[model samples]
Target: MTTSEQLHLPAGSTGRGNYETIIDPGAREGWVHTGLRVLALAPGGSEVVTANGVEAMVVPLNGACDVAVGGEDHHLRGREDVFASATDVLYVPVGSQLTISSKDGGRFALATAVATGSHPVALIRAEDVPVEIRGGGNMTRKVRNFGTVGAFDQMDSLIACEVITPGGNWSSYPAHKHDETVDDGDHQESELEEIYYYEIQDGPSGPGFGFHQTTSSGEDKPIDVLSEVRTGDTVLVPHGWHGPCAAAPGHDMYYLNVMAGPDPVRAWNITDHPDQTWVRGTWESAGIDPRLEGEAR
Candidate 1:
């Protein structure tokens, strides 16, 4: 009963079938009826063959990497500081044998979920967890908590967050929806089930742009995806009205929003698409994404 497919890997583009390069998602193919899978690692080195079943998570979007998982080995570095929590979300367990290495290169964002019944835990990274900004002046958002916020209990299925919408401003602006129900009045519900995963900022001769929108449950039905994203592009929000409009006129737009669902309660309910719901009161006055001046890799 879940339908919405758009998986585009435009950066070298590897082998497999439906847009290949999958480091093993239980042999792919609609990935076990959408158990959730995302991989676009290709920089200097890569090796992740979870050949027993599935249960993986090694996220990093630019520079530094060295994970061995199961056999033990973790190290993810790269940050100008914007809520830094690069890499190390490994939880491979299903005959586990995950391996990854990058000697000063970049690009590595992998997220897999499929443990037959479920049982695989091991995460390491114990310090320097700072990157917070939740609603303040234009609803400014730049959170980065990286794993273990109750470890797999925001709906028990693994969750992740890394949002940064600084350019022309607007990060998920109003237009929201978590499938059917969860969170009401100012929205605050749970039923987890999401995935934004995007990256842009190549302008100034680099070429990178962005634009995303979805709506088709009435409410003026609209689905415009004005595309032009860089660094292993990906945009999927199984539900509806997902927003990402950081028009890179100068450069400053990053997205890394991964969510899980089944309703165990992790809180984050949204439902505002009645004509954009008045653009969330026009963000008070709108101001903050003025190219977000340096800092935050």
Candidate 2:
């Protein structure tokens, strides 16, 4: 992972609300790859937009909203309600206009990714699919097979899941990189890009943030980026030693990570930094983040 893979937005980059606009492909300045942007909506105005060359999925973190994708309208209320015990996934192809409006307006999170070709969009409900925890650490993750699930199959599409990392524990620790596709005795070979949209819990005012670092190929041109991120702030992980370090201050931090590679195959392939790869085998000795003891609202 190199510093060129990371993209950080200063304060007030996105609109208001709990939503922090991470990477707006339409508004991005430098670097060109498939882009991703996240919005944390508050209780007020509705978020309505037409998808141009992008495929999107609406996942609610705290509250619910009425989502309309590709002229089809569906009401997503809660996590358990939207994603049934059977299947909880939604697929929206490119060229579809997604209009999200909330009557009561609570905490609604939207993750949009740039599409390569034409792919039809569809809605996924949690109750429709089987829910299982493929992996766990400081955070417990639930995998809902949307694209691979036989029913909703599209060429070069999106993979969505819910990750709940416990407070104080490192969720994306031992930072890894997936910018390139390589077969080191894992499985087949494929290329895919990824994005990290973060949501952190703050004190009465706000919680202290975290830092992200990326190393270039050569040591002389190394890049060290340190930014204080809040609830709606997003960090772009194109490639590099990407880690979300939660400081001791307010509450726990939650981030919805959206990833898509060039290859049609949907899988997670990561390579850790040689210097820090040892940390992957030491989570058992560490305790949960003590700072997360604060009230969770």
Candidate 3:
């Protein structure tokens, strides 16, 4: 993998004994403040996860698991996979430790970020997650707001969420950026470093693939990343305008987005690229792709 490819981690590239992939702030020099780790285990397998100074959420991408935090065990009724449904999640605050074990083998994601203050451990139920369909027609997609500023009000800097785009459709359209803090009355934007961990469903015949692009929002900072992503791949956005994550003709795409930064106030404010802002108006007439139902299934 090239340096850029390194940032776009493919499955199995960062595997350690029990973990399938690991990307921490320490691993990325220029990148700071956010981290992620994917753990996979066999039946009756378990791993001890601890947050030294960082706060993390135990999100089950596939299968149910038990998270033991602060001497209490919380059973997470997870889904068969990201496509199945929104799964239960557990929040682990800074300076805390936990153990996650699964009855049957499955995978879990630890979405983390640097913390400024401490918070009590919280269990977020799947039904409590606000499920919404954003955009319309082909651009339509499902969003599970489990760890956003408005969804769960307990984190310090971390903002996490998930999106599912049906095959042959686009999500995160109209390239937008949040790399700068803009605080003008009603107009507000917060600087945030983001990570996109993708999982593509199988095509009719074989494996599946998708695409993601991130380019410099302006002349000052030139960043470019266009990758053909597969299941278990990740794209990091340190700074730029990112959008139009497209799922292939027969492959649906699911991504877990983890974001955080130095911003004192945690908010997701973004400025769309001037060239792509017009796309929003078109969505009104385009009608959402029928493949995506109005509600989360």
| TM-score versus the correct structure, for each prediction | 0.31, 0.72, 0.96
Compared with the true structure, what per-residue lDDT tens digits does model 2 show for residues 189-253? 34444555555555677564654454442344344555666656666655555664453334455
**Judged by lDDT relative to the true structure, which candidate is superior, 2 or 3?**
3
Ranking by lDDT: 3, 2, 1
lDDT of 3 by residue, 1-297 (tens): 123564677888877988887888756677788888999989999998879778999899998999998989999999999998899999999878899999997999999998869999999999899998888878888999999988897889999999999998888898899999989898888899999999999976899999998887778767778899999998888888888799998899999999999988888899888898888898878876777666853
Worst 10 residues of 3 by lDDT: 1-10
lDDT of 2: 0.53
| Model 3 residue 187 CA deviation in Å | 2.2
Scored by lDDT, the top model is: 3
Against the reference, the lDDT scores of all candidates come to 0.52, 0.53, 0.88
Write candidate 1's Cα lDDT for 25-137 as tens digits: 32444323123334334566676655354455566565667777665777766442222444444455545676677775555555554344555555544244345554335
